[model samples]
Target: MTKQKGKLGLTARIFIGMVLGFALGLALHGFAPDSSFTASCLTLFQIGGKLFVASLKMLVVPLVFVSLVCGTCSLSDPTKLGRLGVKAIGLYLITTALAITLAITLAVLVKPGIGLELHSDASFKASAAPSLADVITNLVPSNPIQAMAQGNMLQIIVFAVLFGVAIALSGKAGERIAKVFEDFNEVIMKLVTILMNLAPYGVFCLMAKLFADKGLDTLGSLGKYFFLVLGVLAIHAFISYPVLLKLLARLSPLMFLRKMRDTALFAFSTASSNATLPVTLETVTKKLGVNNSIASFTVPLGATINMDGTAIMQGVATVFIAQVYGIDLSLTDYLMVILTATLASVGTAGVPGVGLIMLAMVLNQVHLPVEGIGLIMGVDRLLDMTRTAVNVTGDAMVTLVVAKSEGELDEGRFNDPNAAKAEEEVHLPHGHA
Candidate 1:
């Protein structure tokens, strides 16, 4: 492995790419609104951006399955998995509830949608949400292969955990298979490293296309909603997460935040938690010094279940939509919103357009017009990016706490400012190293 301390770190490079892409996109949107050159460049950016996102997603299934298997097999006491799951999921749910509560309180006080006249003609039709029974029944996959093929994370998680438990119970043969899984995990992580090295270009392309298509005019029209969502997201990331880390994990919140910059940037650029999984796993294990056993389990499960940021959006949007429609929500209605939104986080796991879908469920529960979804849909893309950053922050925070409680965390690495940067060095082949 060769360390290049003088070179710019990945976080700095990605940030630079984002700024340059935004400037370039803005220039084209302003000066060459309908030019063929702009269209061509935008097309190329779209292709690069899509390819990069697909590449990252391509790693999620194998990485999660293999890594989780390795982690489970490493356990000396199987009961510890039960304890770990309880702590991780409990922390995640608590944070989700807190996020939504904060968001609703802020949105109610600010009144972003009051006195605003948006087009009432816009209609939104929400898909039928599965009942709680359906959700629970569907968790156990009928076929693990089908689950993997469909990218059904909850089902895949169920299958992986059960399969891992089996492997752990099989004694000598289980140990041999576990060793093989460990090798697969190593290879998958190396693949993540290779893809991450390409993230600057991907982030640039994604941001350029995003800004080019949705210019400042769209943001201007929905400035209040935009800023409110952003403010809440910032509060959760900077304040909520840090306080939790300090109070529960007893680690330096500053160090944890410092290690998270690159991972958060990836989430913002991609705007998909599943797509950001590989980078998150790498960051949690290699940088934060969480053992792979705990990181593998907590991070993947958190991506599927913990959506504090999305919960925050739903809380704010529910209030904003109700205000826009001139409807007053009773205290009971607000309670229902909090309950629905918190449960919806797990209910909507692995579903596409998760934030909007959850918002629809909340609106329907409160007898609010579902069509009001259109009012906020225009700015959802921008807000989605910020919320995703918060979601991953929650994931990392929970991973640290779980790891610490289990005695699986390395405090030195957690406190090191240069931990992530040092780990980013490119490792060469055996002869070269």
Candidate 2:
């Protein structure tokens, strides 16, 4: 069957691949005990999934640079930029703080990590995180291209805005460059479409391998804690985001969520907000009707710094760790967890093993043993999915908030029920949206 008029849509085909891969993984893990088959299947899944992600990432630099340049240069008033910036950052901070608080509240009320006697012999060595001052200092990149190559979303964004501003000031010459950026944006989005089509299979492979190895028993041991973390994420995704979409942007939350499945799926599979940057921007722009001027800037910054989901993980993990060690944190320690996790959102945004690193900071702040982190890593992938989903949703939320403040968002697109599906139809080879 052709790509068009096929019996099954891309989403359906991907869903099938995911289910089949998962069943195969479970069979290999439990029933078969066939080492060769297991190794071959895992290798196939890894290579295919990695290739799709790499293909998506290949467009990130061009997509972010060009889209951001276009977005910034089009802003005739720099005041709008400042306003939108404040709104986006402010929302992010508030959400991160709220995320941790929700986590703490849930852990206390539900006590998910209580009564667990599992062998928690996991070694945890957390790299020291940068200070807040250091985070600010590092945002100003010495070399813009280096930032882009490094996938430093914050620094790249800072550089893109500056370059865009210079073009905005250059009169006709700047317009020429802006036109080039616009064309680049279109091409990059086409690549995003291509990548999105492969999402179901990618998600399946990632999840199947994750579950097959870890098994449901790992989750059973920390059932309360696991459920608590996941519950908080659900609340944040379903309640927090929808409210913002409705109240601030006058958009339909359902429409946005429906449209976001592909981007969220990509984020869940990759578990890296930076990897999902291109897809997020595309969803916000083409799917959610967010203006590129607002989306390009806000989406990148949000991905880098607005980690509400990760913050929730930190908060819940801190509480769970303390409980496991029989450590009773003082009021001051709880407050410190809130502060540290919120700030760590920005500090460790691009780092690998960020969730673990941020949890270490929280654990230290509350005088809990950092070794407690080992207990949770067994099911980290499951938690990471919920976290990444919240991350992408938070990105979209902040984008809308910024766009509304800038009068840049298109309400018609935000309201359309089909807006989200429209993003998937366009051929995007890079797995962007």
In candidate 1, list every pair of residues with a backbone clash.
Answer: none
Give Cα distance to truth, residue 203, candidate 1, Å: 0.3
Query: By TM-score, how accurate is candidate 2?
Result: 0.93
Residue 112 in model 1: lDDT = 93
lDDT of 1 by residue, 1-433 (tens): 2335438778888998899889888888888978999999999999999999999999999999999888887888999999999999899999999999999999999999987888678778888766667778999999999999999888888888888889999989998999899999888888888888788899999989988877787787678988998999999999999999999989988888888998999999998889999999999998899998899899999999899999999999998988888899998999899988888888765323678987888899999999999888888888888898889989999999999999999888777777767557555578763
Instruction: Give per-residue CA lDDT, model 2, range 132-226, as digits (tens).
Output: 89889998999887887787777888889999989999989888888988888887787777677767767677756755565566776667778
Ten-residue stretch with the least lDDT total in model 2: 420-429
TM-score of each: 0.96, 0.93
Task: Report residue 429 deviation for candidate 2 (angstroms).
Answer: 14
Off by over 4 Å in 1: 1-6, 350-352, 427-433
Separately for all candidates shown, the number of backbone clashes (residues 3 or more apart, or on different chains) is 0, 15
